[model samples]
Target chain A: GAGVSQSPSNKVTEKGKDVELRCDPISGHTALYWYRQSLGQGLEFLIYFQGNSAPDKSGLPSDRFSAERTGGSVSTLTIQRTQQEDSAVYLCASSLFPRGPNEQFFGPGTRLTVL
Target chain B: QQPVQSPQAVILREGEDAVINCSSSKALYSVHWYRQKHGEAPVFLMILLKGGEQMRHEKISASFNEKKQQSSLYLTASQLSYSGTYFCGTEGFSGAGSYQLTFGKGTKLSVIP
Candidate 1:
């Protein structure tokens, strides 16, 4: 079975530019999450989508960050007016369900560099 | 809050054993473990629920101490393939029906033959 996958394995953008990172979750997985890992840092939660419920955007660092999951499968994270601080590996993960002790499967991630 | 992992890094011999710990100040509902090799996605290892259940995968095992909000991952007879950064992601109650994982900085384990 295909695992969670992210597109554009690498991306480089200038400050003030806007960039979008895409994620395709595993088939039939009802929950999806987005996280950011700064160099040598832990995974920072960004956003979460479960089924059709309202997305959880609490982890988003700033207003410039946002995400949307369409058809309960593909998710896109958009960072507006990219900042150097946003340079990090954006990771996407999916699981069968949101509650319980399900393990999230991660994608290869898209490494974004903001100059 | 993010869980805190101890001994940010560790080096072990191929036949040695090692333990990695993750602790949180807040009450935890579950602890998830993952291993990531260089330039790769993190791979799930195991999950320990709040009931203090222990889990084992291959030569790796984990224990959760729900009372203390801590979990430990044990790798026995470490193999060279065990080398990677181990991350512990914690899930706790935030608010009305919300669940998200907060991961630690990670413990880099190096296994040499």
Candidate 2:
């Protein structure tokens, strides 16, 4: 079975630049989540999408962050005007359903570096 | 809030045993444990629900204490393959039907043969 996959394993951009991270969840998975992991600090929840329902955006740090899951399969996390603080690994995960106690398969992650 | 993990790091012999604990200030619905080696994706180990159910995977087992808002992961006769970072993720219900996970800083376990 194919696991979740993310594109651009590493991204380097200058400050004030915009970048897009892509995530392809496992086949038949209806729930996708985006998280950021910084050094020393633990993983931080960004956004989550379950099927066609409204995505959970509470974890997005500011207005510059946004995500969209298209057709219930793939998701794209966009950060506008990248800041140095945004330098971290962006991870994507997916579960079979939108329920608790389910295993979430994670992708390789995209490490973003803002210079 | 993020759960607090004790003993930020641990080192043990291949045949030794170790325990990692995670405590949360808020009530929890479930506890999920994951292990990840350097430069690898996190792999789910097990999940314990709110009923204090204890789940086991190989030599790894976890217990959830709903009343105390705590969970513990026990590694018995640890193996070299067990060397990695252990993360405990606590899921709490927001309002309506939303549930999100807050992960601890993680416990780094090193197994020496």
Off by over 4 Å in 2: none
**What's model 1's lDDT at B52?**
57
Across B28-62, the per-residue lDDT of candidate 2 in tens digits comes to 99999999898989899998999856899999998
RMSD of each: 1.2, 1.1
Task: Kindly list the per-residue Cα lDDT of model 1 for residues B1-113, writing each as its tens digit.
Answer: 88999989999999999999999998888999999999999999998887756899999999999889999999999999999999998888777466667899999999998
lDDT of each: 0.91, 0.91
lDDT of 2 by residue, A56-84 (tens): 77789999998998898989999999999
User: In model 2, which residue pairs have backbone atoms overlapping below 3 Å?
Assistant: none
Candidate whose TM-score is highest: 2
Each model's DockQ?
A: 0.74, 0.72
